[model samples]
Target: MKSNVYMFLLGTMCLLLLSCGEEKLPKPRAMLRLNYPAPVYEDLDMDCSYTVKKNKMVQIKNAKYTRPCWYNMYYPDLKATVYLSHYEIKNNLDSLLRDAQNLTMEHHIKADGIKNKEHINEEEKVYGTLYIVSGNAASPYQFYVTDSIKHFVSGSVYFDARPNYDSILPAANYLQNDLMHFMETIQWKN
Candidate 1:
């Protein structure tokens, strides 16, 4: 029995020596590597007052409401959607702009910071602002494009999962570029 106990201790000592050879390391924190396909954009085929280019990977569907011209541009693989709403400007441009701005401001409570980038294409008559919200906000990006006379269109992006800025950063970034492309390609039918 003493010899068996000694053998067991010897085996444990061998394992401990072998395991201690390499100084242990808490693995350096690693972030997820997310890869998305290169975006191929084409004019979004829709019967609306204006047309814009959209990423081919996006699936456009009507919003879940009765409002006309409201759409949800869904990215199935990313599990994210860009909600879009169109309104006709009829002496309510100020209110429309305010509403769009207010929507973005709503996320301020949870956002680390908000950056507004103005978009202006005088030739296309598209003038707007893109609001990029950082941190764990429900919506990471929002924008409103308007001719400032006849039409106003606003959009916001939301992911299906809970907001975790670090986890969703890559996908949010890809969608940001896509949204910018959408804004750049707007052409009013009227």
Candidate 2:
């Protein structure tokens, strides 16, 4: 009886020791990681009236409606497109500015907020505002750069996916930086 009890106790202790080899821990939650390549830009080679640098990742194509100097800069990987429309400012600067602002305002209903940054390059005669729209708006970015006399160009970015602010935030931000660089490198044809 004593020997059997000792054996049983030793077995129990062995079992416990074997089972306690390592403490099981719940793993931390997984997070989504997105990585994009650094941008390489080159002068946009087109018959358009104005000149601007564009990321090499984008493909420049005529817009669907195909107006004069209207283009769509498409990022195949990101499934996003930047729509650009150029206009010769023929006494319509006020209306052109109004239209651009109105287009941005249309997103206000769905946008959490809209923040705009003014851009002015006195020597280049480039002046405009970059509108960053937050929320699930269809267009998260919009801008218009104009010499306020002879040239006006406006652009907006739209994704192919359904408007989910969180899912598209990273791509939107990447495009935003590209757009800023594009704007800075713009030079109107005199």
Candidate 3:
């Protein structure tokens, strides 16, 4: 009888511990969205090209710059640069991305009751800090910006925290909608 009582108490404690642990979920680091105008590449007649897709929400452009990697994405709420970088320009891009991340962190804290946290994920081709924001009234969002030896790129998406899957979806969808509109209006100058 004593053993049985002890086992029951232990099981209850384990369950309580599991329930009390902080729930971890994927979140966005920023709330900005991208939009681009339709592409008219053939007219350019250069090695570089641009295209519009996803109902004009994604503007894709390619150029051959010093680093052999040049592309740009402009969303209604956000603008992204993925292009060749001269050795000197690399540091500037890095600084810009870092500044943007810091700005996002400050904004997240001020976003109602949202809590902001950062997750750093790096890869050879792409790397940047992701800001994840969460709150009862707010949807979790991720801000990801990355680049490569010759290119720089960044983006964000509002996503719900795992398991809950309740609040973030709307925000994510909203961001997507805005991005599409943004891409449609983008124009690249000669």
Pairs with backbone N, CA or C atoms under 3 Å apart (clashes), candidate 2: none
**Count: clashes, candidate 1:** 0
Can you give the TM-score per candidate against the true fold? 0.87, 0.85, 0.32
Off by over 4 Å in 3: 1-88, 112-124, 135-142, 156-190
Ten contiguous residues with the weakest lDDT in model 2: 45-54
Tens-place lDDT per residue, model 1, 13-116, is 99998888767769988877999999999888577899889999999888998698899999998999999999999999999999999989999999999999
Residue range 83-174, candidate 3, lDDT tens digits: 22212235577676665566456545435433333333342233444344444323234343333343333344422233232334444444
The model with the greatest lDDT is 1
C-alpha RMSD (angstroms) for model 2? 3.0
Please give the lDDT score at residue 127 for candidate 2. Answer: 95
Q: Cα miss at 2, model 2 (Å)? A: 20
Backbone collisions counted per model: 0, 0, 25
lDDT of each: 0.94, 0.92, 0.41
RMSD to the native, candidate 3? Answer: 16.0
Order of quality (lDDT): 1, 2, 3
